[model samples]
Target: MKIGVLALQGDFDAHRKRLEELGAEVVLVKKPEQLDDIAGLVIPGGESSTFLNLLGKEGFAKLKGFVRMKPTFGTCAGAILLANEVENPKQVGLGALDITIRRNAYGRQVDSSIREGQFLHDPIEMVFIRAPKIERLGKDVEVVATEGRDPVMVRKGNTLAATFHPELSDDSRIHQYFLDLVTNGKH
Candidate 1:
């Protein structure tokens, strides 16, 4: 199956390499039209608002439509984009996940850190870089991973989101889980 990584900004290459390492065909999706070519999509970490500006009206609309139908995994700013409600000066989002996300809740770039989190039954290393915080989860949303009491990774239906950069770490489980999700056609 072909997996597309939103490559307009952020560390998209990392996700691409990680997905490729996991034995899936990878696409660096720089255009909205590329969405039609992939079975699943990975929206990488970046400045959320800039993602909006970069996507513009047409691209953003295309993305919003795609996420609702395809399996999508989003990290950092990508998570912000997938949220239903955005905080820290609220902004519009794709509304793919029933979540309230607060941008940069983990502090700034200088404050970024490598932390441990529980991913389902396993302990995983999570890289947080100007990360957002999952403030509230709607009833349908399930916590897939957490750092302390805060949810770092969450999912609902075909949409999966992470406040941390799973691709930045050596662990392949998170990406693997997403692959499994795509493979099994699970939410």
Candidate 2:
């Protein structure tokens, strides 16, 4: 299956590499129309406001529709973009995931860190770089991974979100989970 990585900014190439290693076809998605050629999409970590500015009105609207129709995964800033609500200076979001996210909730860039987290019922390393925190989850949202008491990874329908940069980690389990969602057509 082909998975598209939103390559507007951030560490999108890392995601592409990870997916390719997992034996999946990868697409570097820039324009909204690229969404149609892939089975799933990954919105990579980047500056949230910057991503919004880059997306503009047309791209943002197109993404909104694409998220509703397919399995999409958003990490860090991408999580912020998919959130229903954003704080630390409120911002517009795609509203694909029913959650509230606080941008830079882990602190400034200086506070970026690596931590051990729980995922797939096992311990996994997580990388957080100016990451947005998943503040709250909706009733239908399932907590798939967590860092201590906080929900770091969540799933709602076909949309998956994480507060950390899984692309920065060596593990492929998270991406594989999303891939399963893509192949199963869970949306």
Name the regions of candidate 2 deviating beyond 4 angstroms.
Answer: none
Q: Kindly give the stretch of ten consecutive residues in candidate 2 with the minimal lDDT sum.
A: 178-187
Taken over the whole model, the C-alpha lDDT of each candidate is 0.94, 0.90
Cα lDDT tens digits for candidate 2, 19-78: 999999999998888988988899999888999998999999999999998999999988
Model 1: per-residue Cα lDDT over 38-123, one tens digit each:
99999999899989999999999999999999999999999999999999979999999999999988777899999988999588
lDDT of 2 at 17: 93
Q: For model 1, what is the C-alpha lDDT against the true structure? A: 0.94
Indicate which candidate wins on lDDT. Answer: 1
Supply candidate 2's per-residue lDDT for 117.
89
Where model 1 places Cα greater than 4 Å from the true spot, the runs are none
Report the error of model 2 at residue 91, Å: 0.4
Q: Number of clashing pairs, model 2?
A: 0
